[model samples]
Target: MLLQDKVVLITGGSQGIGAGAALGCAEHGAHVAINYHGNSADAEKVVAEVRKKGRRAIAVKGDVADASTATAFVKAAVQEFGKVDVFVSNAGICPFHSFLDMPQETLERTLKVNLHGAYYMTQAAANQMKDQGHGGSIVAISSISALVGGEYQTHYTPTKAGVHSLMQSCAIALGRYGIRCNSVMPGTIATSINKEDLAQPGKREYMEGRIPLGRLGRPDDVAGCVVFLASDLARYVTGASVLVDGGLFVNLQ
Candidate 1:
């Protein structure tokens, strides 16, 4: 087990890629703490899954956009698991809309949840890891959109780019303390958030055709990378961006 006996924390972990990472870490022998904004049932379901894997698990309810939530979430994890070894900043939202008619509320909420949320949680986790004196890993769930434009994601792409940038800067700032910060950029993952879009006629097939892998991504696809970065196998890895996009970006002509 790559993460045996380690403590891992994740935000927006009730579903999608975050939930996948939660279960993946547990399978690798880590006690897990998850944060979800709403939907207690979903959060508890993930906790149950983790426990079924024979790993200790807890679900903390809170909105990552709130700075205070970050502190409380970390405190709860420490209170339950003792220390934080891996922190995955995976909480985010993308409300697709035409750039011209994008709602102010949607834009603001996206920035708050995707960018500010990652910052606060990462900062809180880094502080805990530093105090523990054992070093830690931080993985931010950036998007492939960070490298390319999206017709309906004008307001969302910048936040991801910011997240990717965050890891790069934090990797430098926390290097002396042995904290590694990295970002994983996933492409067109088949999560609930985008299920409707993919459901559109021919949309799914078109996307699959574009990717060299010939299939859309699953939550586990991104989770596996998170697991690797969290493990000692990547001990020397830091300030990096790993693309879990299945060749979609490269397939571009």
Candidate 2:
């Protein structure tokens, strides 16, 4: 197993990509920790799935936007699992609004949960990894929206762009400590986060035709990449941005 015996913590793991990644890591022999904001039932479902794979698993609850909560969640994981070898800051929220009338509160909320939350959550995880002296991996879930800019995401895209920036900066700052940081930028994924919008007439069809690969991405599509970055296979990679966009990036460009 690529991640044999490793301890991995994934934020927002109750469902969607986070849940998929938790299962992926567990299948590869990593003890998994899932942190959910407000869905214990769903989080427990993920925990159950991981345990069925014969891997140790736990579900943590916290609002990643708060630094103290972020810190506490990592500390709690360390308490249960001894140490963290991989941290996936995957919790995110995207609310749509045009720049002309985007509310300040909306922008702030998006930044707090997506950008600021990830910044400190990963920092706390990095500290744990450094203390262990084994080095580790940090995978920030970014979005192609960061690169392409969204029509209704004037306030949202910057936060994702910020995640990419954070990955690059941390890759440099944490390199000496043997810690590596990178990002996985996904495009038009079909998850609860976008379900309502996707269900609208023509939305799904429009995206299907737009994406070069002829479909929206699944949670597992991105999960596979997360496992790679967190595994030893990506030992030499850091500050890298892997796109799980199914060739739409180059097509629509």
Per lDDT, the best of the predicted structures is 1
True-vs-predicted CA distance for residue 2, candidate 2, Å: 1.1
> lDDT (0-100) at residue 186 of candidate 1?
98
Q: Report residue 134 deviation for candidate 1 (angstroms).
A: 0.9
Per-residue lDDT over 41-130 for candidate 1, one digit per residue giving the tens place of the 0 to 100 score: 999999999999999999999998899999999999999988999999999999889999899999999999999999999999999999
Give candidate 2 regions above 4 Å deviation: none
Q: Candidate 2: lDDT of 234?
A: 97
Question: Cα RMSDs of all predictions?
Answer: 0.6, 0.8
Q: Poorest 10 consecutive residues of model 1 by lDDT? A: 244-253
Error of 2 at 122 (Å): 0.9
How many clashes in each structure? 0, 0
